[model samples]
Target: MRGFGELEAAVMEHLWAFPDGATIPQVHERMQADRDIAYTTVMSTVHNLHRKGRLTRVREGRKHRYRTTASRAEHSAELMREALGSGGDPRAVLSHFVERIDPADSRRLAELLATMEEPPR
Candidate 1:
């Protein structure tokens, strides 16, 4: 969500929610209910995201059924890692992010990272 542009995030959210996946029209219809967006606009957004490796689609008759290529957590983690590994001040960024979390959430994130640090053969 942090690195994704507005339309990209919205498209991802739609795919994540629609587990069965959907065609451009379906996604456009669902999203248009909330916002005054054009079909071509949604279609363009979905195509651009697909080109960015954020979406995958299967051919269904004459239409393509689109879905999220990765889970929300997986995408977010990849974005976070890219940001941290960009040679910037990761420590400062992390400190800022940690400061925004509740104490309980900070502990839970620490525990999750600790659990993930185990070596695997």
Candidate 2:
């Protein structure tokens, strides 16, 4: 696994792709279009996602429909926070990232900060 387990990433991708929701069979079919994972693999992956709080399920007939519990941006931010927290001080970690910001971007950030500091909305 590069970052997350193969099943986890695959399941998350499917959940993020469909904002509404999808059943296990739907996800399995989609995955089949790409690489051919077993149906049970998809089912258990969705179950694990549910347990991880990355997905929520609703019953539909005899099967359960799964949907993303959080938006992609929300999930990414949480993961970033967790990754940073895993190290030492977040400030120190962020400071390293800040130092590497492109010069043009740094200037833009300063301009935005100055505007934000101004009183009034």
Candidate 3:
């Protein structure tokens, strides 16, 4: 339910870009092209992501190929839900959230809310 740190977020972004999944070395190489990061650092970050249940891995010979357990949009929604629930008043939180978004997104949110079925009491 927690958000990712800088390195973990970068690793997740890279993995999300590759739908077929990527090995630690593959991720490290991609990361290295942009910055001077160590291979072991990427390896540790990927392993931590897997341990956090944010990623799923399959044995690819000696190394594990990793992919995100949820889509980027899904992860964002989960984080929003967590944030909403963390507050004492969800209504106030949602009100603030809606107020902060752009007009187009506000309209879209209204449209989505209008289409949702009411829960049975």
TM-scores, in order shown? 0.82, 0.77, 0.92
lDDT of 2 at 55: 79
lDDT of 1 by residue, 6-44 (tens): 987887788888988889999898898889999999999
Error of 1 at 21 (Å): 1.6
Pairs with steric clashes in candidate 2: none
Which ten-residue region of model 3 has the weakest summed lDDT? 112-121
- TM match of model 3 to true structure: 0.92
lDDT of 2 by residue, 5-121 (tens): 877888788878987899999999999999978999888888888887777889999998899877777777787778788869989987886799998978897899899999996
Cα distance off (Å), candidate 3, residue 116:
1.7
Candidate 1's C-alpha lDDT?
0.87
- lDDT tens string, model 3, 1-121? 7899999999999999998999999999999998999998999999999999999999989999999999999999999999999987999999999999999999998888877856756
lDDT of 1 at 105: 92
Worst lDDT 10-window in candidate 1: 1-10
State the TM-score for model 2: 0.77
lDDT score, candidate 2: 0.83
